[model samples]
Target: MDELSVKASSLGDNLSAPDGSDLPEPRRDFHDEQYLSQCSLKSRDLLLLTCPNLGLQVCWFLLMSSGTPYLESLDISKSITSLVWLTGPIFGAFAQPIFGILSDESRHPWGKRKPFILCGASCVATCFLALACAEDITDGPTNAPTADSDSTKHWYTQVFAIACVGVITFAMQAYQSGVRALIVDNCPPQQQAAASAWSMRWNVAGNLVLSTVGFLDAKRTFFRPEGNAKFKILAVVTTACIVVTVGLVSYYVADSSQNPRGKSRQPLTKLCWSMLCPAELSKHWNQLPPVSHRVCTIQLFAWVAWFPVLYYTSTFAYETVLPYNFARELHEKGQLDIRLIEHAELHRSSSMLYFAFATFATSLLLHMIEHAMPAFDHTQPRIWFFSQCSLGFCLLLTFFARTGATATIIISVMGASWAVAMWIPFALISAEISQPSPSKLGGKTGWILGLHNMAMSLPQIVSAILCAVILGALRWLNIGDGIAWIFRLASIAVFYSAYLINKL
Candidate 1:
């Protein structure tokens, strides 16, 4: 038997023979409960879960995809755009952990997660609409051009937009953590990876379609000639879909009462403190099985490596590589006025299209690997180590990238590593951490997910601050010269993550 199997067997033995206790009545197997739940779920119910997640994924892609364009339309400098991108993760980082804890303790009739999902989607839609309105007003001929003019209006618009994003981000965190808990609550341990993989398929499909739509909308001006109208329309449409899908899904997949509500489960100050205390940390930490801990650590490192790349890669492409290549080519032909927007859009479309294709291919490959190696028991830490190493290697190749095609090739490889980084660790976590007994069905699943979100959020915060500083410093030192070093730093982080994952 492999290490995981041996450890699981040992756990089962320990649970079976509690120290100094009289023999108790045998309980139903956890796997049996999960099997029954899966059997009970109709095709329609499954569709409900899948559809909402797709909607959520689409919205996520839309926001990130449109962010740069929206900033450009506001007449913010490229330096400011980079800073705003970094700021997103700062707000998102704090929001996710707090929201996770809130969702865990929440007890509304709409269910713990559904309320947050609705709230989050609404907030995001509202914010996008507000931005659209701002864009329309700012770009109007009525507005006076001045040094302070752009800064003042941009600041207000950004404040509102950022606040809305923060709210939606918190909501998304609650929804994701809650949904994962729901899956663990309802699905058997053995099928967790399969279920997660299936869920991720929907996520990928949504990303492909959404990114395509955003790309087309940006390129063709589908919404209107008026600034940011497309963003508004897309936001409204996406939010409506999320609300309807989540509402229907929640209605069909009623919460199981297998885990009883305790009066002490109320979200109280004392209880919060008790949970946060270091002594309780050990108790809660001990509750996770060894495999679960390893998987979580692996996930932590994977996100640390991956999110920085995702957050900054597009910026790097547009600001650093694309400009330099296009400028050099144009300089040869004596063409000087290379509009940033035109160049940015061209590179954005190419890069996103490449990323979409890479993700689809990687997903298919992983699916096949899972099917072919059905009985393999590789741990997440090992997978994480190798993936991080791969990412680091690809990123380092950027130093040697001298042409657009070479840059695209490097970015595509980076995208593939990103694809595995996003999905694989979560799948491993689902497989490793789930309880095998119905009695401990809940099994601190919320806390585990909360910790996972925390890990993701912390690095996001760091990246935002660090990237801003690095980009700002680079701008001061002459912009063109500093871009490569930023990428090099990202590569270093990936290598460091590989090291950390190996230790885990």
Candidate 2:
């Protein structure tokens, strides 16, 4: 028998032994049968698990709400602004997998995952503080945007932003991989679906709260007076909230022992090197279960199709469709004095609110279906592919949508599908990778999760660089509707992705 099975068997033997001998019947603990029954969390545990996710969702929304505007204020051209915005995902993509591997290999008295979580939270908080302080350091006598703008430019602001994203990404990967492993370790196989459901529910709850916050922040009152100062205050407050919530959850949630006394094995590194080497890549390549390889390939393609559309959608709606529609309406009504920026902000806020509601409603519907039927077992890869295709198609429709209301509805539908696409494939990949095993349990778990993150991150980097190039090229061509090219390219990618998913 392998290590875990042997250890479990030994424990069973010790517990059931007729002992008047070496081991007397261990005094029955308070958790006899009743506690065990109660421990298997039903729907309630899922809801509680989502608390940490809520904090994360808020941080994400806040970042998305302000990031582009903040970049624009830096006096950078629109094209370069898009490129600079890519710094977060590029750094985060590299950082997350390494952290995941480290979490897998770590051995500490407190636990392997908790240390990373605390470190990540601390880093994110520090970054937000620095970002908040940027204007204070740069403000000058005339208060005309500074002469030493390049020198006075808060390099630290960008540094902190990248750092905060890196740490958060690291912490997220570690906590998710470790906690999901912990669930598999502690609970029976039958209960895993419930755990997955709970995790998704928490994600939706967090998204809902963040979306609401974004909507409120878009109001004139919030952005009009002392705009920079107000945003900094909000950032600091939200960062603290995330750190505290994640910290508490990590602390209280029990971690399964990394190596049971008699069951401990060689370190993960030694095993990984011995089993998976360049020389042996072909020999052992086929050893991995076919299902896992298929899922990973499908995931990579789906992300490539999805992320460009998502990252650019808000900007497109605000800059292109909204301005055109508002300007046309004003011209028709003979009121030519409407401010473009103010109108754009309103449209942006409205779109965010609508997207939020649609996402929450869809999540609720999916949850109810899972609760009632409990076996909504569609193939995840197929579902994820179709969702991404749908998003691309919807985005393409925006190019031709004549009415503002129709465009808004199309964008909202795309947003909702994108939200579902993000998590479902991840959930499936996590389930597939964490399947019961004898050898290299920790290493396999970490590698699978790390690869999954890499898939998500790499696509963002490509999208950022490619989109900037496309936009720049289209602008050079004087194609007034340059943004439409982006949506069309995304549709083509999605169709390619659909083919890849079908092959898988």
Off by over 4 Å in 1: 1-47, 75-94, 135-158, 217-224, 257-263, 271-287, 324-335, 339-344, 376-383, 436-442, 479-483, 500-504
TM-score of each: 0.78, 0.78
Candidates in order: C-alpha RMSD to true structure: 7.9, 6.7
Query: Looking at candidate 2, what is the lDDT of residue 330?
Result: 78
lDDT of 1 by residue, 256-356 (tens): 32223342354466445544676865565556656556655555545554655665566556654455545656779887665655656556566665777
The weakest ten consecutive residues by lDDT in model 1 span 1-10
Overall local distance difference test of candidate 2:
0.56
Candidate 2 residue 175 Cα shift, in angstroms, is 6.0
lDDT of each: 0.59, 0.56
TM-score (C-alpha) between model 2 and the true structure: 0.78
Best candidate, lDDT: 1
Q: lDDT (0-100) at residue 336 of candidate 1?
A: 64
* Candidate 1 similarity to native, TM-score: 0.78
